[model samples]
Target chain A: MSYRSIKLIKYPTQEFTPDVFDITTQAIPTPKEGEFLAKLSHLSLDPAMRGWMSPDTESYIPPVTLGDVMRASGIGEVVESKNENFPVGTRVMGLMGLTEYAISSGQGINPIPKELPAEAILSVVALPGVTAYQGLFEVLKPEAGQTIAITAAAGSVGSLVGQMAKNLGLTVVGVAGSQEKCQWLTEELGFDQALNYKDADFAEQLKSVTPNGIDLFFENTGGAAQAPIFERMNAHGRIAVCGLIADYQTDSPAPGPSWLNIIKKRLTIQGFTMPDHIHRFPEYAQALGGMLAKGKLKYRSHVIKGLESATTGLDLLFEGKNTGKLIVEL
Target chain B: MSYRSIKLIKYPTQEFTPDVFDITTQAIPTPKEGEFLAKLSHLSLDPAMRGWMSPDTESYIPPVTLGDVMRASGIGEVVESKNENFPVGTRVMGLMGLTEYAISSGQGINPIPKELPAEAILSVVALPGVTAYQGLFEVLKPEAGQTIAITAAAGSVGSLVGQMAKNLGLTVVGVAGSQEKCQWLTEELGFDQALNYKDADFAEQLKSVTPNGIDLFFENTGGAAQAPIFERMNAHGRIAVCGLIADYQTDSPAPGPSWLNIIKKRLTIQGFTMPDHIHRFPEYAQALGGMLAKGKLKYRSHVIKGLESATTGLDLLFEGKNTGKLIVEL
Candidate 1:
């Protein structure tokens, strides 16, 4: 039998182009002595993938090498196994790459429960959930009654972040790219206020919404909304910079707000990536799963059909076209 | 008997022009009940004065109200006293303002040892010393063998910070505005390397000096050198934003480096003012004093003559003209 896999052909100079990746057919290989071979059911498309495609070796994780399967996290079911831990029919998830089939020794892979749907697993129990949990609880350390402003607020990670903050009694203000996302944040997710960054009077609206000023900032997208939110930060504010999706595609990212406000307000700005805190994934996933089961968290997936769609679908995240978590279902 | 006092008559719109201050003659008042009359001998001129001269109430401390004695820290002798804790002839240091005489209830005052010269006391045991100690040890949390890049390396606070870091076995790179200051940092303060920020190849020099990349950044001056130093920071770098002398005078401060590097390197940048940590002053002062007594700390004072010189002498700090700790002798 034959399965298809996409391989990165070249590193992007600025932004990803279709030519950067090439899909190839491969015959399914049998598992080795201690390995398990699985057929991937779903693939996750995240903003962090942009960093992985670049040639920057200094990043949290090494960039995806050319001529290799494009790196991704996915849900798969074990079809063939030489290992007892991941026997036949066992569902697993990890950085299995963008492929219909994968072989693993269970090094970084985790056997997931069979009950949850693939969309829920990829959206809330995967990278997005764990990242939101870590950034909101650990980095921002939100307090009840504290106002938090999260950028990309309707996206996978950000939506989870806003929901978690709201559940903890924080006044959550979400910043997104479109009015529909903003309405979803406020109406569906119960975010206190949601502002569209594209509005001409966005800064004025931000100031009006956050009368007491922002105490915590969960920065996912570093763009136009950053300066306005930064200016409204109260004294002793803490900022958790989880992602810079807006700047990910450009070689010349915009300069950040002046550090004068940083000093004036005695702010703490910390940047973090999930790879650095990978060891805590299982622990974070459990907490997030509990939140999901208790109905304290709500997640949406912008599912794209087939493995080949992932190449072009990634731009949906960069362009803010995706309504929720960008996922590829094979 | 009368004393000369400089009062803030107007808030500076951008930079400090001489007209903002008024030299007023006042009768030296007798101590009432708990108050003590201090004959100010030496006034410390710091870069923080620029912030105090502004109308921005959002700053760390309340700006000096117009028509009040221009706020400053100084060393003085309690020539007349009503309080037992501050006996007559006792040497003291505190925020006594820009005056030849001050009356105090000894609220924030710290009685100092009569042995140390006013220069050494103000430079190493007062604001500069405690600020440097707090920023280096507490904020940056230096680990031995790590490299630290300190801006305004020849200034009072920066000089002590570099010296303390060097004593802790860290490789120190000092960034200054002048060749003379750079020479002092390397030769006198024992920094591993000192680069003049004005040099055309300053960034290249910084990169060469910090071959392993900067691990800790002591950001004092937010100017042309900031971007270069920020760009060279290594993974998990910690930046302590103590002062921004370069931006204090300008109404429009330059934008800081892109947040992209913050994520790529997982850097933690914190802004702090000494006022917030004032409760720990005595503890920090004692440690810094011990370092000074053991000859582990070296400081030089650029003493200007008379209280009247303070209004103009204050500009030396903003202009980066002061060779050492700027002090006004009465």
Candidate 2:
């Protein structure tokens, strides 16, 4: 059998464009001993993908090498298996890359509940959901009455964070790019309020919504959007830095938030990546899974068609065009 | 009786000079219904003094009001007491300001063991020592055999942090401004290694000394000194930001450490103030006080004579001229 795959042609110096990658055809080789063959069905476009494309050596995960298949997360069905853990017809989720077929060595790939829809597996039961769970409960540790503020409020992680925080009785304020996203955040996600970051009166709106001051800030987008909200932080506030989508496009240093306020407010800022917390995945899947099973939790995804639209799907993530999880239905 | 006092005539916009304050004579005020008369002896000069003098409204403690007595920490003898908590001849420590005498409401004032010397009380058993203790043990939570890097290694808090971390079986690397300070950190304080930030090969030296990578960074000086060490931080490193003397002189935003590294290394950076942790003071006083009594810990002080020398003494702190705790002897 043969399959098509997106390969990284060159690393982006500033921002990633479609020209940096190209589609190539390859023969689907047999699985090695203790390995499985996964035919990808869905691909997740995450903000961290931009960081992985950087040529810099500072990232936790090494940069995706040129001429290699672009790395990504996806859900797929096993076509063949030499491993007892993953038999043929098993549904799995992992770093399956932007490819139609993947030969997994049983390292990162994990079998998931086939009953759940592909969208649910990729959104709430996969990387984004686990990230929100760990970053909120373990890192940020918000109390019930505390006010929580987040950027990219309508994105996969930010939307889940607001809903989870609301479930715990915390006041939630969301910042998004457009008025429609803001309305969705408040109406669908039950956020206390949502403000459009592009509006000239964004800071004023944030001030009015968070009259008690922000106790926890879930920072998904950095740069100008984050700096103003940081000034509204309360004493002993906690900031969980999940991603920096705003600054991921550029190689040059981004403007920083005031360090003096960190001292003045006695803030605790922690930066986390979910890959490091794979041990707690089952716990996350159980908690976030149960909420999704009920009507208590909800998620949305902007699904693009085919492996050919992978780069465009990622572009949708950067432009804030997609209201929820940006995905490619292969 | 008459006593001399230093009043804040003008707040410093840049570096503080002698003209910002003036020493004036006033009659010793009598104790009120619940107040006590404290005859101040050794006034502590700290790096946080720069923050208190900032005209900006962002600080843990409110900025010292213009024409008011400059706020400070001091070791004093209670000459008269109208409250039962404090009695005549009690050796107490509190915010006694830069004054020959002060009338205390007995709120912050605490009586110390009469046997402990003024230098020990001011240096290792007071605000600076408790700060180092809480930051290292509580916030950073360094494990044994971990490599810890500290800036301002010869100053009051940094010096104690080195000694405490060394005692806890961590390899301590200190960064200071001068060779003499480095020598004091390594030879006297038993630091594993010390590097002069002024050295042209400062970063290279840091790389060599901390070959295992830094696990805990006690950040005393921010800006240029911190940026290099941040590059050498190990995965999941903890940074206890005790102070930022490097950026305290100016209100305009300073160049910050790389946020990308914070995410890449999965760092936990917490900014803390000792005043907020008063509940833990007795615990610190007990642990550190016992260490001081047993000769397990040591401290030094640069004492300047008279209330008139208060401004110059603070200048010594900013210049890095004082080898240890800078204090004004009145």
TM-score for all models, in order of appearance: 0.99, 0.95
lDDT of 2 at A109: 83
Fnat value of model 1: 0.84
Per-candidate DockQ values are 0.88, 0.59
Query: Chain B vs. true chain B: TM-score for each candidate?
Result: 0.99, 0.98
lDDT of 1 at A250: 91
The RMSD of every model to the true structure, in order and in angstroms, is 1.0, 2.0
Error of 1 at A35 (Å): 1.8
Candidate 2 lDDT by residue in tens digits, A1-330: 699999999988887798999999989989989999999999999999998898767678899999999999999999999999999999899998999999988898888888998998788878889999999999899899999998998999999999999999999998999999999999888999999889888888888888889999999988667877888999999999888888788777685664777788999999999879989999998999999988777899889999999976788888888978888998
Q: Could you give me the TM-score of model 1 versus the true structure?
A: 0.99
lDDT of 1 by residue, B1-330 (tens): 888999999998998788899999978899999999999999999999999988888888999999999999999999999999999999999999999999999989999999999999989999999899889988899999999999999999999999999999999999999999999888888999999999999989988888899999999999988999999999999999999989988889999999999999999999999889989998998898899889999999999999889989988888999999999989
Backbone clash pairs in model 1 (N, Cα, C under 3 Å; residues 3+ apart or in different chains), count = 0
lDDT of 1 by residue, A199-248 (tens): 99999999999999999999999999999999999999999999999899
The DockQ-based CAPRI class assigned to model 2 is: medium
Off by over 4 Å in 1: none
Interface RMSD of every predicted model, in angstroms: 0.6, 1.7
